[model samples]
Target: MLSPDKVSAHADEDWENAGAGDTIDVERLVAVVRRQWRIVAVCMGIFAILGLVYILTAVPKYTASTSVLIDRGNSQIANQMQASVAAALPIEDDASVLSEVELFKSDSIGLAVVDKLKLLDIPEFTSPARSPISMLRSLLNFRTWFASDDVAADDIDTLRHNAADKIVADMDVDRIGRSYALSISYTSTSPELASKIATSIAEAYLVDKLNSKYDATRRASEWLQERIDELKQKALDSDLAVQKFRTAHGLLSTGGQYQLLSDQQLSELTTQLIGAQADTARARAKYERVKSIIDNKRTDAIVTDVLDNSISNDLRKKYLEASKLEAEISARLGPDHVQAVRLRSEMAEYQRLMFEELNRIAESYQSELQVAQTREKSLQDSVTQASSVTAAAGETQVQLRELERTADTYRNLYQTFLARFQEATQQQSFPITDARIITRAQVPTAPSAPKKPLILALAMALGAAFGGAIGAFREYRDRFFRTGEQVRDVLSLEYIGHVPAIDAKEAGSGNKDPESVRGLQNGNGITNYVVNHPLSAFAETMRSAKIAVDMENTSTRCKVIGVISCLPGEGKSTIAVNLAQLLAMQGSRTLLIDADLRNPGATRAIGRHAEQGILEVLLEGRPLKDVLLLDNKTKLAFLPAVVKRRVPHSSDLLSSSIMVNMLDELKAHFDYIVLDLPPLGPVVDARAISPMLDASLAVIEWGRTSRRVVRTTFAVQPEVMQKCIGVVLNKVDTEKLKLYRSYGSGEYYYNRYSAYYHEA
Candidate 1:
């Protein structure tokens, strides 16, 4: 049994064991989970209820959609072009049709829509608002939502313009994919209105397209008419210029051959004059030179001397031949040999031939000069005749060129006027267009705002997160260690035994019911296998541990042991009583002592009074038989604490020489003497008395008295701990025991000990 002081000491130790922060207690966690299941239920239920409410109240929407196949309308356009154009175009790729399609999307087409629909009143096409809506919004607090309220229009045109701009927003035009087609869709509060607008826009666009084609055709016709007129005038003017020049110059009949004949005659005459002049000059020079020679009147005489000297000429030849021969000999043979000398002699003969030829040519020049005089007179006469013919041809060419230029001018003017007349005749045949409606737009039946499901789901998720936060905060603040497993795992201790809970009625094993603490086989004993099946497992486990501990030393077989606990009512005294009787039943003599001097809950545990027990023997020095209480059923003996001193000084008496002798005597008489000591915490009694024992077991209430008290029970002095065998955790809940699965046969443990109550 644990003294009050010991229980207090153990509690302090257990608290200190829990570090910076205590860890989660599984027993407490189980209790919390049991208590807070309703909280979790409420949170989940709230989320579900909110989801249902959102589903019930939210507005439902339907999407309205339609599709159209775009039509490029190019084939029809090409056919129209082929029918309308007269001249063959040199174009490889014509852009007129594509340009027309672009024109349909232009502001010109938009204006065409305005014209057709008479939408000049719409704001988009009308005059600027001039601080109208903006000024109103700034003035009124409600302006953002009611911005258009105070806008003032100056005239019907402004009103129509604003309306037109607003209506334009009700229509859409999209170029569909890569094709030349366009898709247009309109949305409106009224289905019919949207359909009307879409269909109207399409009709208006087609009208604009037709107008584009018509306008292009009209412009083409007008331009071609003007060009044809200009070309006709140019042709007429060219003809008139040719005719007028002929009239002015009077040689309009000169054909193309006349100019060629005159040019040829002029070229021949010019050549003849040049030759005549050259001949005359040559004759005059010859006559003058001959006369000078005949008269010897020329006095610059170097030429005359050379002409008259024959000897000098012969010397020149001989020297020339000698030089030539020397060159020949050097090239062909030796320079100073006999063949070279003979060749020099032959060259001397030919040297005279030069003077002979010169004399002959001078004689011939005199005869030729007389013949040239006669020819010069004849050539001069021919040149004069040719000059007269060339003059006549020049006059004729000038007249014919003037006539041709006049005729060209007249012809160009005439042609220009005639072509203009011809082009005007072609304009009335061009084409135009008639516009009609195609597809209509439809109104949307659903709003484009507020998708309910997505929004509500987000809210529910947020609510659940908040709810879980509330649950987690409450779990962090609790403070006790609630399980034996916590002590085992957290403190790193061995588990020895689990004592079944002892009820208050069947608690006393010392005097009233000794049989209850007897053998493991009977139906009605304290630790019986039949009557108290749950306790039997605890007893069996204790027996096994006892054998293991005792086997380490043979002297342990007859050693006296003690049972201790963390607090009062933790089944320590009961465990001591049952254990001793069990050993006694096994034919080993056993004694059970209740040694708590301060508070003896152990006496109450055995249904005995704590009067004149240990205190009477120690203080008055009486015989041990005066206080010993013996039960015969299981052959167990008991001693109760007689002193109920608020401050008991029993440490000296228990650890004294007399107590030591008494313990030795008991050890000799019994195989196991069980002492139920005062708790080690409140006083020094248990520590002082520890050296008199072989081993001790600490008892702890399973789900009560926390880890603090249990550890303090074990953390006594080394003298006390030397006798500390292990521990016993008492009063486990059977149904909840299944949570610890390592106790594979825990149900049997619970069932076996639980039968004791039924049997009683």
Candidate 2:
């Protein structure tokens, strides 16, 4: 027993750790699993059966596989031959190998295989077998509703394309790890067909590669031939232009030298003119010196040329001797001596002869100067003529050189293209590919799909997951009181005890006075259960309720306790009848009143035979003693509620001054007054008269009544909740209740104390 404020404070303290509800609780989870295991098992069994059915009905498909090795080196020979005309094939890498795998599964390869194998003729290939699921999908197709009836059927080409697409769709191509080997697999209903298609795919891929290479080489060869012919003609034309230009310009070369004849002549003339100029300068200088000697009569002056002349030297010598002889005769004799006169004449003759020799030398020097000057002038004229011819040829040589360069370029192109054409022809003749089938596809003996065990296992797992989800949802929604701990923790009210549900058969059994039980309308034996079996658990729970009432109202002589619940069907009426009986059986004066004017469950249970009840006493001013029905064995007085019609304002009637005074009068004669009030959730009668009541006992259906509804009921009727002494969990299934037993809860130790209680 606890006051409302103390209970509220205690509830708040319990709620301090309410956030912990969000965390995972292992024991709670185990309890939920234990309670819901049957649901999970049923769901799993259903799924497993479905999986088995699917496996049995599904069509078997055989997958045949073949391996193809991509040998890039196989094409090296062709690559080398066609290197000039075509680019080299790419070397195999991870990406390239994967590209090959994709190519193997390409529509082109599929189409090629289809055509070679004449797949269009085969019905299986043209119109493949559809699975049940596919057929069902076709049946449910929404597009068919909108489609026109005049839609054209597929033609032969379209059928072929469809067959090829089907082949590609069913084909799988995978490259082995980090290798150039590709695994080609095909799935089909027939093993042979699967093997044939897989093998055909590999062969078709190789054939496609070969055809591609051959076509490329053929095209390259034709192009190279056209280029080679064009270049040959261009080479010939360029050579002809070079010769023609050389001839037009008269730029003739000698001895196979590139230099023109006019240029050689200019060079030779320039050298000769330089030598002639030098000779002319020397001759002029000699001629001037000799003339000066002759004119000035410088016989005493020594000239190299004059001195070399024999006559001049002889004449000079004779003159020198004669002068010497003249000088001696003049000095020895007189100036007019005859011998001196002869010497003088001889000297004069010698001088004249020397002068004549000097003149001759001068004339010879003049002749040599004239000859040298003439030669120099002739050489200069030749050089000037050659320079003019060479200058004109130089301008023409520029055009000749350009024509020669063009001829050389065309010739080189022709040779290169000619070589490329040969290589292209060779490549076209000897076509090669990089892919080859290393392992031929073989027919598979076993089906590759619809693995029974794995599918069943997966189905079971899926079912378990779905079941677990449903169980979790149920657990999330299970916000009901299942144990006494829930009542204490959720509502913060003292937990009295749980009343086990009594079946009708068990309630009527072991009763000697059937008429007396019938008169009290105790067919379920719930109203007088404590009188029949005081040692039973149900009767014991009543005692606990009585104890709670007595504890809460220790100061009062008579405790007026109202038995209420949040909702109907929670056994509040049964609880009130049993509690009153237990008090009366224990030698305490007890009065059981059915104050629930709306439903009157207690009146229907134990006072159904009474003609008048609490309603008659209240509205008609009837005496309470006249309407009271007393149990002879327990001496418990029962006040029934008889409603002739609907009572809409039941709460107003229950809270009236007449009702309060009636209860006060009954309390004077009874030690405990138990009133069966209407559930607080649907009516306010319980809360309206709660001010006059000493205490209230809340009866909650175990695992059925929601904790939220009870809390809300109390929240709306705080006065009733404040006077609430304790809560009794009613209508409990003891077997199932064990699953919800938490540690430190009353139910957790129910088994240990169960030996003390027995039904009569």
Most TM-score-accurate candidate: 2
- What is each predicted model's overall lDDT from 0 to 1? 0.57, 0.83
lDDT of 2 at 558: 88
Candidate 1 residue 666 Cα shift, in angstroms, is 2.4
True-vs-predicted CA distance for residue 582, candidate 1, Å: 2.0
TM-scores vs. true structure, each candidate: 0.42, 0.71
RMSD of 2: 13.3
Off by over 4 Å in 1: 1-494, 501-535, 545-553, 567-569, 703-716, 742-760
lDDT tens digits, residues 1-760, model 2? 4766766777685775486677887888788998888778888999999999999998899999999987867677667766644544675467677667778767789789888889878888765458798788877989877877763555566877889889988998887777778899999989999999999998999898898888887898889888888998999999898888777766666778566788888888999999999999999998888787777877688889876889988888888887888888899996689988988888888888888888887889899999999999999999999988888777777877788889999999999888888777777766678778899999899999878899999999988988888888888998999887677777778888899988867777422344553235565676777778789999888888787777777899988888999999988988898888889889998888898999999888877777888888988999987888777777888888988889878889989999989987887798888889999988788889999889999999988988998887777888988888888988999999988986666778989999999986
Encode model 1's per-residue lDDT on 1-760: one tens digit a residue: 2334545655665666566247765654566565455666677678867777776775543222333333334434543554433332221232533443454445544444566656564333454444778666665756356656565655554555455555555455555455444566655444554554556567666666556555665676677667666666666665566556545544323445334444565566667657766766775565556455435633222333345668646655565767677778867888667767776665554445544434454455656666666666666666566667657666656766666565565566556544543443432343333323333345566653245666567656766665656656654532223344465544344456565554545632322433543212222234333124423555675575466446534666567686766566666665776676667666777777777777765565553443467777766777777677665556666666665565345788888887887787777777878888776656677788888777777776766665665565565555766555566677755444544323323443555555643323
On the 0 to 100 scale, the lDDT of residue 429 in model 1 is 43
After TM-score superposition, the amount by which residue 510's alpha carbon in candidate 1 deviates from its true location, in angstroms, is 12
